[model samples]
Target: MGLAGLRIVLVEPAGPINVGSIARAMKNFGLQQLVLVNPQCDRLSVEALRMAVHAKEILESAVIVATLPEALQGCVRAVATTARVRDWEAPLENPRTALPWLIEQPTQPAALIFGREDRGLSNEELNYAQRFIRIPTSESYASLNLATAVAICCYELAQYAESPEIQTPQETELAPLELVESYYQQLESLLLNIGYLYPHTAASRMEKFRQIYNRTHLQTKEVTMLLGILRQVEWALKTPRKDEKL
Candidate 1:
């Protein structure tokens, strides 16, 4: 099978030609889903359409959303590409090693996120992904065009999409990313209400929490259990204890 379940997400991409080129590349690799998160350029512009050539259908059918969360709706796995080293707990992996994992759950939707052409993904944006990638290049010229990066990853996806030897056994149904994101929001609110995280520091502290949870690949039931605990804790904080009433 091909990578039909994988969604390619571009975050605030600015170049029309680049977007078109990515669509054409996706067509070449048998990928169809294209999602644009607040694109800065008109995807259907002449330049884009011309570059897309025979792949114009992919561009026309692309999903445009206002936020990253919206673009990632219903996905079970997400891998983000980055070029710079950051102070994060997650180690940067190569495209060959990490791309295969995305297709392991072929029945469920997955996402591959590429960031802005100028700055790439921000720290907050990076938090949304379960894994990270950094394509190797010569030290003298490390920068890569956005479309080039997508094409390279697409090539890798096509190469391994049908390899039975690379498929990992699915032991359980993984939780949807939206479900896990909801839990994170609730957990952050509870922590802030209880003064565990101040307004000034909640984001950085939550980054650590995300890094921990992202690695777990929590199941759907596991996330529900976690949400239940958060809701109960929230209720407890509002309710007066028997001793306090006395």
Candidate 2:
């Protein structure tokens, strides 16, 4: 979706220096949207503004939210960064290989999600993303500072933005993450109603469902069809038979 539609989401970022540097990197790369989830540090603090330098406006204009899902409101595609290999089958690709996918939608909004400076993303947080990016570093010194990591990813995004291949349109379009999320909520409630998913196991079972849907690269219309079916089922469940006693 090019740089304009790309969002940089930081989850629980605790350092003003890191937050400011990330804002600067975003500006240097032409990206405009920034969403912070429950940040511990004051993003507008003097230290942050000093680090931001000429990109101070980015720091000032960032959207702050209480949760990751709120940060990702209307996004259609997202790539979450993690330091360790996760348990899920989703491949942890390098930024060069994966970041481009976030911008391929051209007209839609996409996101690059970063976790807290200390622990990276929890597995539950990682599930929100369809793709994952792991910057390759030496095994002896694998840790990259949060700001440095953001700089590397922003550079890769900028590189991909300039690629000739990215300008062409793809055959299929991804549904907005909001729409897909509605489908998930509906599917989960239905599964619960039918006893296919108990509250105790629903979260884990739904994770498997997420992996399947993410792998299929489901398109907008396909998700719409699924949502329609869910709506119909909900209607039937709520409707009463004429012969039934009041």
Candidate 3:
């Protein structure tokens, strides 16, 4: 369930031809799930259908959502593809090394997110993915078409699926994006209340924290522990207990 379990997420795709070609590539690699975030063109138009050919079902069945987070709701793992340099500390990884991390959890859903045809994914949009991958191209001509990037990543995913080492022992089950998001929201509110984060600069500061946690590959119990600490902070803020520092 490598490519099969991964959703090909396109954020604000403006071209029907690109979307249709991506759908066709997905079908070629045995990938069925496709999610579109705020698409700018008609995914079901005659243009899309013409490019999809025999893979028209993938185009027809694509899930259309309003935001990147909504596209990744239940997914436990996600890898975002980009050609630009990121402000975050995490190093950009190659597709072969990064993609297997997505399909490793057979029971859990995962995602491979691609950005817009023109501008690509913004920093905020990229925060939704735990891992980041960039395809190596000639420095003189580094631009890659939206569908071309998806085709490359989809091929890598298909290769991972066919390999015999698809399964491996795990330390713990990876936490879901929704669960991590809940922690982020609560943590942000608590930090703001304590004055650790200012209202104006909190968003940027919190992204640093997100980068730290995303690299940790946190498990379910770990998130629960951190949330427990936040909950204790919440309790202390309300009761103002004598032993604890507010």
Which is the better candidate, 2 or 3, if ranked by TM-score?
3
TM-score for each candidate, following the candidate numbering: 0.97, 0.91, 0.94
Q: How would you encode candidate 1's per-residue C-alpha lDDT over 1-246 as one tens digit per residue?
A: 239879999999999999999999999999999999999999999999999999999999999999999999998899999999999799899999999888876788899999999999999999999999999999999999999999999999999985667756665789999999999999999999999999999999999999999999888999999999999998998889988964
lDDT of each: 0.94, 0.88, 0.89
Give the candidates in order of lDDT, highest first.
1, 3, 2
Clashes of each: 0, 2, 0
Error of 3 at 65 (Å): 0.8
lDDT of 1 at 217: 89
Q: Which residue pairs in candidate 1 collide? A: none
lDDT-better candidate, 2 vs 3: 3
lDDT (10s digit) by residue, model 2, range 119-173: 9998888878898889999999999999999999999989988877666566467
lDDT of 3: 0.89
**Cα RMSDs of all predictions?**
1.2, 2.4, 2.1
